[model samples]
Target chain A: MSGGYPKGRIRREDLISAAAVVYGEAGYHGGSLREIAKRAGISHAGLLYHFPTKEALLAAVLERRDAEDADREQLGVPPGLEVLRRFLTLAEHNARHPGIVDLYSRLAAEAVTPGHPAHEYFERHYRDARHRVRDSLRVLADTGELRPGVDPDEAALAFIALMDGLQVQWLTTPSEVDLAGALRGFLQTLLTVPLQP
Target chain B: MSGGYPKGRIRREDLISAAAVVYGEAGYHGGSLREIAKRAGISHAGLLYHFPTKEALLAAVLERRDAEDADREQLGVPPGLEVLRRFLTLAEHNARHPGIVDLYSRLAAEAVTPGHPAHEYFERHYRDARHRVRDSLRVLADTGELRPGVDPDEAALAFIALMDGLQVQWLTTPSEVDLAGALRGFLQTLLTVPLQP
Candidate 1:
């Protein structure tokens, strides 16, 4: 990324960031590549040189977000309770990044239909997300940290659901919702032990 | 509505239904008025005569859906845990109606951004929705049905989030999620008594 084309790398990042903003505001279908180029301070051909198509740009954007998450959470590093703890941290992280939240909320909603470009991406994303949470829950269950009679599978679904659902409300009316606090309160209901700092 | 032109009412219904499908599939920013007109089997001019603008059509579509929900749920009538029960029933109902779920999921997510056509509408919608759920929880608290130490305000936020979050998962991979069953299990965790049929 640095040796042959350092300027190219910077330009690509600029385009992706600008694309995220446009797509976040107007959604994938409604967002225009021309507008993205304008926002990125590049020509249309220059933008296309980096991302051959709009779908390709979207894929890059989505991949970058996941990579940032994986790195930030150190996912699968310590495993178990730490993963769940990271998710709470993730909620706190998301509260400050409204642009990222808007992008995800819009794309996930649109991708529900069968033929959307990102449909399969989101399906896999949620499946992986659930698996990660459920694995941590299993760890808690084995350690006697999880409450008795709590099904890991069901709890995972509800946990993931709560996180996703809270974003919508928070974005709609940020003044009314304490996103991180609500998430922490929810976790207290499922576990017997305190979340370690 | 019926006296002057019975045909007008039926045609309007058809347009609204078609608009829902188009908007659900592509979202408000991406969905086209022409496409809606085509799907409803009417001329573009005829569609414009009824709708005037895309934003106006969207308002009608949203208003109609709310009216149907209000009618079906008998909302504000026989309030309390019954309202919660009705929400469980509503999940069952939503399971049967994918299109309705699609419309709501897509619109709500898209409306998160400021300046979107349906932005304020969703702002008010979530506010009213949370209020209804909180009122029901208050009733449960008074009757000693709510779990001790469970804050009704926090519980309401989580409840709404669960419902909203479940829709995205269900829509992404329908075969994997049992929307109504998951909702029931979450309610079990919150309430002391079994939900009465």
Candidate 2:
């Protein structure tokens, strides 16, 4: 993105990054396009040249975040025990990127209204994320990793819930809550059959 | 609060409720005092007469919600595994209150920024909530109800995390997520040495 004279694409990336900060702080409805333009070091019309509408800009921002996350996280990591291990790593990653976390947390909460802009995006994200989690648990359960009577689907949802809940605590009080350690302790209790000494 | 006109307190309650709805929909930064006043069917001056500033109104709304939550949830139902069981019931209650959940979820996310108005409030809330959860786990650990090697503090934080995380998911997609059932499964794994049948 740096070496070439692809000024148009660079301008687009700059706008998206600034928009992420604005939307992260002020929320989608609260954030203004003009503010995003100002933050990105461009005029309002310059921003409009790149992104014709707010909705378009928002979609681009989300798409870029997804791409960045996939590249950073290797989203295709194998399931089962790796999912458990990656849960810790993902929390660690989120801890470093407060801007993305704040943007996501704000949008997800607001999007519960069904007609909100990010509603469909979040609906799909959660459904897919939960499916992967359920598959991972089912894989472990098949190998007798889970204790008797622990439903794979239930464990998957609860594990996801624990991850989300710890994230909220971490975002609010970083020093007091250790997201990975807390999650590890939870996994220890859940997988008591001793995969570890 | 209605008939004879100790209407001052009633007016305050009405304003707070209206503000909650506004904040829940538009978020804290997006919502305006004028809108809250309009929603409450009172003049802007009259609203401010009750609450001198927007921050004052926000504080009042949060305080009232706290009072309502305490009154509704039997926060003193004895500790131990009973605390674990009560977690399920609390989630059930939250399932019915999407307004509070939406308002809380949005505020909690925004408050992650250190300077946000609800920042200190949420920091204190998690600290206190985690401490209570830890104390409850300690009570159970003393009775040998907890599985060996389950750290009381860590388990407490994880349990709290699970509850908060579950609430967010439930609020977003109520039909797919079973808040209570998922919680019960997590607790079963945590207390798996079977102090019960």
Candidate 3:
């Protein structure tokens, strides 16, 4: 089907990008691979030649989105309290791209089902994020940023919960939620209050 | 289909109950109204006669779920700080019913899309929940339950966020997440501290 190998790779990338948009808009079950093919300006068969199946396409799309985000953010080595500010920046970035954020929020909820295609992705995502955030909070506590008696691990859990919970509300009523502002307010509280145990 | 009979009303109730089960298990997009009809022991045509379309059936199911919940809990007159205790009881009850919780989380996420069938339901749900929780928190603050510097509105927002955030993680990894325990911990913090601004 491909006269040139490089072009075929490019086509595959195009399909994944298009599929991301479709998945973001329609969600996993509601999204159609054929519709993705149309958006990518390729025959459905040609799209299948690269992805082979909807599950394969989904995996590829998720993988690519993560890779692209890591590259764009260059989110390397933690910077302690400064790292919290980075989350606000990321939230601002996400607000600009509601489609991707909506897709993620929707999939995260759907993946609660152990058998859902994206189940493993979400489980790993939450576990890693939780540990990383906890470690960062510990760094703050060690540096005397957190108030006395505030357990870093507990703070981490509550902080992450606030972020995720705000996302759910934000997605439902975008106009009513100031995603980054809410996080900023919470961070200020963490700094100012003892957040007693 | 009705023939001026009470049986039609009973059938509608049966269909809504069945649909709730189906939706809870498979989510809105994954759920099939026909399957709901089958479970209700009614023909597909009869189901349609009762609920003209899948969206109509979804609305009915949601309405019934709300009504039954209100009846069971009699959550009409907000009982101030006791309302916080009610949330813990509700979380414990939810822990025993993963299907409904999963369904709710899934639908809440799905309805993030402005055009989704359940979008209005979620938007209204959040607005109402936030207001009610805020109002109850104010009652507590007025009764000297809250410490100095505590803002009822801010406390309400954060409280709701924690409950929702905990629900998402709990649904994914039930054994690791003690939903009620987490909420209880947060509630204790709210009572013991000012949650400094």
Q: What are the per-candidate TM-scores when only chain A is compared? A: 0.95, 0.90, 0.89
Number of the top TM-score candidate = 1
RMSD of each: 2.2, 3.0, 3.7
Q: Indicate which candidate wins on lDDT.
A: 1
Which candidate would rank higher by lDDT, 1 or 2? 1
RMSD of 3: 3.7
Per-residue lDDT of candidate 2, residues B3-64 (tens digit): 44578878888999999999999988999999999999999998989998888898888888
Consecutive 10-residue window with the lowest summed lDDT within model 1 chain B: B1-10
Q: Pairs clashing in candidate 1?
A: none
Ordered from best to worst TM-score, the candidate numbers read 1, 2, 3
Model 1, B36-66: lDDT tens digits are 9999999999899888999999999999998
How high is the lDDT of residue A110 in model 2? 77
Error of 3 at B57 (Å): 1.0
Scanning candidate 2 chain A in windows of ten residues, the lowest lDDT window is A188-197
Q: Write the per-residue lDDT of candidate 1 for residues A1-197, one digit (tens) a residue.
A: 35358899999999999999999999999999999999999999989999999999999999999999889977755548888889998889999999999899989998998798899999999998888888888998999999998998998889888999999999999998999999888887788999865
In terms of DockQ, the best-performing candidate is 1
Lowest lDDT block of 10, candidate 3 chain A: A188-197
